[model samples]
Target: MRINVLQHTPNEGPGSIQRWSQEHGHEMYIYHPYQFGNLPTSDQTDMLVILGGPMSPNDDLDWIEQERVLIRQLLADHKPIFGACYGAQQIAKTLGYAIKKAPHKEVGWAPVYLKSDIIPGIPEKLTALHWHEEMFEVPDQADLLFSSDLVKNQGFIMNGNVIGLQFHFEPEADNVREIAINDNQYPLEHNDLHQTGKEIIDHGVPTENKQVMYQLLDFMVKNS
Candidate 1:
């Protein structure tokens, strides 16, 4: 299978997802518009994985809106999509949901409670990597999958083929360190909802979360 990833920045590239592709013997391609200077359509991509970025879907950027258009086209085609963080907000917006700044910044390791059983192997609570201050409401009729105390819509699935998560399900240790050093939102202030960079990195990133991520990705590939 051919999986294409839409990445917005250099540092926050697909981490374990890249490794998962290799292990599953699937070809993976990435689109970094700042580097490539062009976006790709979903004609050749069997599955689409949209990664998180610093940009909000409401930003005055062409690519942001273009990605949403691409998302709409993919939805019309009934293609499988996985949106994480900022990408998740985009998915919600495409379905006419409102995306707004979260009540507080969630910028470290935290727990997201699973609220639905549309997909198995996902736990009731998973510690995930988070780095965003924006959140989205659940789109109309979409299956709200996960939630946290800070937000009511942490994730949602539409048509069983498109999945969106407000947190990173597959967090690589190196990627965590890179974001901590570069994102400047890290070294979190004293708050119960946030964690320090060391606190997030010291545990070495839970292998179980990555396992759940792989299971969800495999399920999408099979069901798509």
Candidate 2:
């Protein structure tokens, strides 16, 4: 299978996703729509993974709209898609949901609780890395999957194939370090939900987090 990844920035690459794809013998291709506008057509991509970035989906940019068009086409074809953070917001916006400011700017590691058993094997409650100031409204047709204290709509699943998470589950230790370094100006002191750069980088990638990501990816492939 060909897994097309839409990477918005250099720091936010597909960390554990790449590992999962390779381990499962699936070919993965990454496209930088923001920088190069090299997104693949829906037919060329067997599955799609959208990575997070600092940019907002509401931005009036050509690449952002182009990416949304691709997402719409993929949904029409019933393609499996997994989106993280800003990518999640993009999916929500494409689904005609409102993307609004979060009550708090959640950064670093935060606990997220599973609200629905849409995907089995995911823990009822677990700490996941977060880095976002915007939140997506859960589409009416989608099942709300996860939530945090600060954000109500932490994740959602639609049509049994499209999954959107407003957190960082695909980043490994090295990937987390790179992301932290790139966004080193995070204001941890402003909120208790936020963590310092040192605190986040030191924890690296938790084993359980990686395991859950793998489980979700496996489920997507199974349904694909």
lDDT (0 to 1) per candidate = 0.82, 0.89
lDDT of 1 at 186: 48
lDDT value, candidate 2, whole model: 0.89
Model 1 whole-model lDDT (C-alpha atoms): 0.82
Q: Return the TM-score for each candidate structure.
A: 0.93, 0.96
Clashes of each: 0, 0
Off by over 4 Å in 1: 185-192
As for candidate 2, its clashing pairs are none
lDDT of 2 at 149: 89
Write one digit per residue (lDDT tens) for candidate 2, span 1-224. 99999999899999999999999899999999888878899999899999999899989999999999999999999899999999899999999999998988888888899999878888998889998888999999999999998889999988888999999888898998898887788645465465788888987677898899988888876776
- The weakest ten consecutive residues by lDDT in model 1 span 183-192
Instruction: Provide the lDDT at 13 for model 1.
Output: 86
